[model samples]
Target: MVLRPHGGEKVRLMVVGRKRLPDAERHERHWGFVEAIADSAKDLEKGLRAQSYGTRTRGERTQPAARPAGEGVYAVTLEDGQMHLSFALELPAKPGEVQKAFRIAPEASYALSIKNPEKGKPVNAGLREEDEADYPRRLQEEFRGRRFAREDVRLLDFEGAEFILIGARSNPEAEYGLDLDTHDEDYQHAEVIRRLRMVKSRHPIKPLFEGRWA
Candidate 1:
């Protein structure tokens, strides 16, 4: 994935797949790897926090940890007074059911916890509004002149962070449900939106950039 900082410089984030380990081992190793990266980054720059995203299946279910996982992972750090992060994920065949998980930026999560220890509700109302407002433009840009449909898009408070879930299906005539074929443009669009939303929601204070950009 390509991430552009506030200054317009782009950085590419890549996920290295763990092919030898079983699901359980990979899950454990992934978080450890993330922590190591965050720690190393912090040595150079203090106050870096770990963040992540990933996909989970029913059989793959595991007890929740202090940090959560998704089909991907990220490390959020401070850069020139702005929060910066990178994305990485394993893109496997579309699971029978896609469960996107997110561990919000640590500092923000902690602040929310202190403010409402009982509820820890994410202050994402404004983010949701911005997403809805930008959906049409994002869809048009992603679809271009092609035909497609928004399969599913939702925002939920999960594990203390706001989870933005999005899916799309292309060639509307080909199937009545989400076209899981990863190579399909529609499926690609959905992935882009998923990642875009995650990054858009990352902020030290409030969420930034309301719209999706490839």
Candidate 2:
């Protein structure tokens, strides 16, 4: 199995299994499946970045690579016999909140997940029957109605959080990670496109995407 953590490397371990595990035992089965990582004491310490004190990008070799100091929301999952541990695509509900962005793995594709309706009942969230669901991937209020003096940054959001989204214009494999099934050609406004790139630039976009697709 592969452990895709925020650390600079992918920790791979092999788990021998009978190939058939009971469904009732699935949730509590993770602790039992861990194989011998054979990672040294120093290696384990560095994996968690126990020595990190301040935030540093992956290329900043001067210090350890780790998350920023704050309340970071993450999506941790173990699926298909591979453990996926990474920062999630998200926005802040309040001001002065920092979104956690970790290093981009050149080996992995960073896709966006733009929409999520009420996972709970509608009545619990005080929603009308016809109300459109929240576009979690959509950029609601970026920079909180503010922008830099010179940087013409655009922002958008998405949830095609994997290999499925090509993010291209009119391509069959391409998809926009938005609440509405949008495409690059369908976007009439340049401002919306600009904001999407801004959001992509934060953590793992740079040379890989350059914010061409949000």
Candidate 3:
């Protein structure tokens, strides 16, 4: 598995890692990881709203459509000043059912926490700290030396949740059709309208873009 920031700009911060889940039940555990992040971000945004200080003001939640079978990605944004912090997750199944774990760029020094059934656990992997000067060298060393990426699978009762804190990753990708510089009110207004519709619905429905504020 390889990890790189997407769109090749400042730091898109995307992880193209792989995992394995054979049946439908196993897949749901992975999905739960996505869900837990959404729920957690929502709760955080609400708290930010209540504080109304340097706290997050407007926010949006979105869950993109499922990618191919066993592939999922999620993103959330907290509108803070001129910058928005985006948190995202990507999950893909690999081969075998034996448990194996891999950590990518763990030493990059950002607040890291896990939100799963157990909740709030610190991830003490070697890569979680930020070694500023050696980052680029470290990234190449880790990726180049790997003869094969570790892919593990298991009957996971809980696949666990992945939580990431992010600053705006260089404006929305142009493909998303968002013009960040224009300051268009229509886009923001439309988002709010759509979110209202979703919130009013009684059923459990996932948005095309989850964890984004309207």
**TM-scores for all candidates?**
0.18, 0.16, 0.19
Question: Relative to the unseen true structure, what is the C-alpha lDDT of residue 84 in candidate 1, on a scale of 0 to 100?
Answer: 24
Model 2, span 1-214: residue lDDT tens: 2232234242322221322211221221211122223232223223433243434555433343332211122233323332323232212222122211222211122122211232323354323434432333334332233321111111111111111111112211122221222223212232222222223223232222222223
Alpha-carbon runs more than 4 Å astray in model 1: 19-27, 31-75, 78-96, 99-214
Off by over 4 Å in 3: 1-33, 36-160, 166-182, 186-188, 195-214
TM-score of 2: 0.16
Question: What is the alpha-carbon lDDT of model 2 when measured against the actual structure?
Answer: 0.24
What is the C-alpha local distance difference test score of each model? Answer: 0.24, 0.24, 0.23
Residue pairs in candidate 1 whose N, alpha carbon or C atoms collide under 3 angstroms: 53-70, 53-72, 54-70, 54-71, 54-72, 55-70, 55-71
Ranking by TM-score: 3, 1, 2
- Per-residue lDDT tens digits for candidate 3, residues 63-115, read 33222111122222223311221222222222111212221110111212222
Relative to the true structure, candidate 3 has a C-alpha RMSD (angstroms) of 19.8
Local accuracy of candidate 1 as per-residue lDDT tens digits, 1-214? 1222332222222221231111221222211011111112113122122334454654433332211122333333333332222233333222211221222111110000001122223474312332222233443353233322122111001112122211111122132222222242232343433433333223121111121223
Cα error, residue 54 of model 2, in Å, equals 20
Residue 12's lDDT in candidate 1: 29
Give lDDT: candidate 1, residue 11: 29
